[model samples]
Target: MTVVAHPTDPTPARAPAATRTAGRIRGLDAARALAIFGMVTVHFGPFPVRGDDLASAAYRTPYGRASVLFAFVAGVGVALLSGDGSAPRVRSAGRRLVLRAALLFPLGVALQKLPTGVAVILQYYAIYFLIAAAALRLADRWLLALAGSLTLAGPMAIVLAQRAEPSWFDAGGNVGIRAPVALLRALVISGYYPVLSWAPVVLFGIWIGRRDLHAPGVHRRLVACGAG
Candidate 1:
């Protein structure tokens, strides 16, 4: 006797990658909003404290934190722009990032000319975009390795450089665009946020962004790691 064959149920169709990608990560948005708020509090808060508890707390809370969060978010953006690591996508990202750097460099320099009292981090941010563009083709493992290497090497180099040229590091307070060499030095090593030390943060962010962030497993891991 012949046995009757039964058909298996068809698998459900999942959303396209692009469709999933288009959805915003609310967590990132919230983090970004917090960073922005902190930055504003730090920048625009009343100077000299004047015994105001709220102002004192605001300054204490967001002083160093906001800028770092901003840089990490910027790195995440770089990873998103790289888009699946395809050659064409990478090339497109490179162009867009390069143009952003170009725009930001000049704008940042111009901002420095003002008597704003704050060391504008825009120029350093521009350099970071340039670095991210250059490393767009690197694999995630290599990116992680590079970031770790930079984190160690950068501070060591800074110490050595400071010893070698104490005058260079000592001459702080915003070098002007007219002095290209000095400006370059400040951006690389002497500025408020030197690219060398900060690059690791950006690179790590890119690595995080490169992951399957849409996955619940990833979300849980990230949340746990962040909380820890």
Candidate 2:
């Protein structure tokens, strides 16, 4: 899928970085930027955009949606990085994604130890990457089916898990690796962005990522879905 500089170019097999960037969808870039801004607003404050009267309203906009957007965008990234679902090199992609997770998990743990009150989401993000690695091997229909099932069952499962073991949830707040089992519980069920509940969003993003996004028909369908 390399975009050569010209039809007769000798290096048609490999596109330059600039050439690749030129071919990128600007809309996706805007979405990613907006999502990042929203995350920053949630983590810090929307001070730059606020007036005295509109402060509360501004803060409310990105509250819960930021993390969700991040999850979705992360899924899209996974798809694009692994060659856009056409004919993924699953083993290679899995290895790369797992290595990223391995690096991120420890870093996330360290960030959690900081005095800053923000709940570190990087650890959960690491888990999501691992999930994406596994998901890269699935067909589109299966991915959609899995996402739908998770959407229905994940939140319910979390609620039940919390009710059954309140102490585990409590331990989740204590950010340390001393209790590995409790850490696992928190990551999967009790943490701020638990994988059980959030994985579907990522899966849906992967589904979206698989599509021919450049198509006008696809854009129309996406718009219709949003409106519905």
Candidate 3:
């Protein structure tokens, strides 16, 4: 990743430190940038591309994975923006997240009225933010444990719910303009990215955010587990 020299190079030559954030996690931002690029490809390019070419590879690769990365990274952002491991800071973070969600939910609903074919993820995104807000107070280990359990059990629960009563409640895609009853159903049970299935990724990312990324042990675990 070091294009100019080894990370531990002895050379004193370097760029200005103006861009460095004393406490920022650079890796999370890099991952987010890559996720955004992947999402762009998925949104603009045609699926299947009819060949074993770059387009087809892009189409197939980013379909589901990019959004997962995006959701996870957003959770990390929440943790970072909330500051560190403190109660007041966490509450402040929760307020910011809730307010942002409030603004985004209305924008998402308005966007739905447009003719764009995109299956907007904003409404589901707002819900994910809400979930992350509540989860930020949990200890790191508990967050990881919950995320792991959710990852294993969420799909099964979704399957059961769908079988038991499919779309029995559709709050018209969570658009407040669309009947109030349909809002809950569209956001939870019948949405394109159900929180039940996607929220774990966010939680897991939040768990990751709680780690000391500068530590060698944390980096090793992230590399090992992410590779796995």
Candidate 4:
């Protein structure tokens, strides 16, 4: 008796290994550049026109909102750079994170001394890198769960800390000078871009990465999400 090939049988030509990696998404790059430009404008305090109040709406309106956009875009960048769920690629990404963190830590500390009351986001970005490293290793479902829980817990943690006495975690005082520990705590608590609140955004990016962004449907989804 002769046996026939089954319709469900795997075909060598259709294997994933046969496909090449997708090209970089230019739209994402453009979005990132725009985010960076907005961040600069927000941080630099407008054009500082002569004899003006220097506190015009253009500068004030964008300051906090622009920084939040930058943080969200940074999360997308992290997800894009990790090549979605690929392990080997993410390991290399983790190394890059360490190098960037090492370089930015000192600069961040120095910037804190300035009168502007700004905490350089690179410091927080570095801490996010460390958290992402661990988060990336988990299953996608678990990653999302962890991200959601942390996002909710972050504000509550700060609230509880505030009520607990001493209040070292509060946004005032010498808390900025404590180096690594301070950096880690700020990333979780007082900072606007706290890791707990922001990690879910990154994990969302990771989930986005799992989809085929080059597809028209995916692009539309991205636009909708970005708009929201």
Top lDDT hit: 1
Candidate 4, residues 1-228, lDDT tens digits: the string is 111225763311111211113777777677677767767777675754545465565666566676666666666666566664467877887787777777876676567657777656666666766766665566555655776787688668777866774355665412455565765566676565666666666666554554455668667867897689
- Select the stronger candidate by TM-score from 2 and 3: 2
Question: C-alpha displacement of 56 in model 1, angstroms?
Answer: 1.7
RMSD, candidate 3, Å = 8.7
Q: What residue runs in model 2 are displaced by over 4 Å at the alpha carbon?
A: 1-22, 47-52, 84-88
Candidate 4: list runs displaced more than 4 Å.
Answer: 1-21, 47-57, 169-184
Write candidate 2's Cα lDDT for 1-228 as tens digits: 222246664321322223323468665777789888888877778554546557666678888887888889788767667663334455777788899999999989788878887788888888999999989888666777899999999999998887998776875644668778778888888887888899999998877766666667667877798579
TM-score of 2: 0.83
Better of 1 and 4 by TM-score: 1
- lDDT of all the models against the reference? 0.79, 0.75, 0.72, 0.61
Instruction: Supply candidate 2's per-residue lDDT for 221.
Output: 79
Across 1-228, the per-residue lDDT of candidate 1 in tens digits comes to 111223551211222236336779777898899899989988888443767687687787888999999999888878778766678888999999999999998888888878878788888889999999987778655777899899999989988988999888775538888889988998899877898889889998877777666678778988898789
Candidate 3 runs further than 4 Å off = 1-21, 167-176
Candidate that beats the other on TM-score, 1 or 3, i.e. the better one: 1
Q: Please list all clashing residue pairs in model 3, or write none if there are none.
A: 170-182, 171-182, 171-183, 172-182
RMSD of each: 8.9, 7.8, 8.7, 7.6
Order of models, best TM-score first: 1, 2, 3, 4
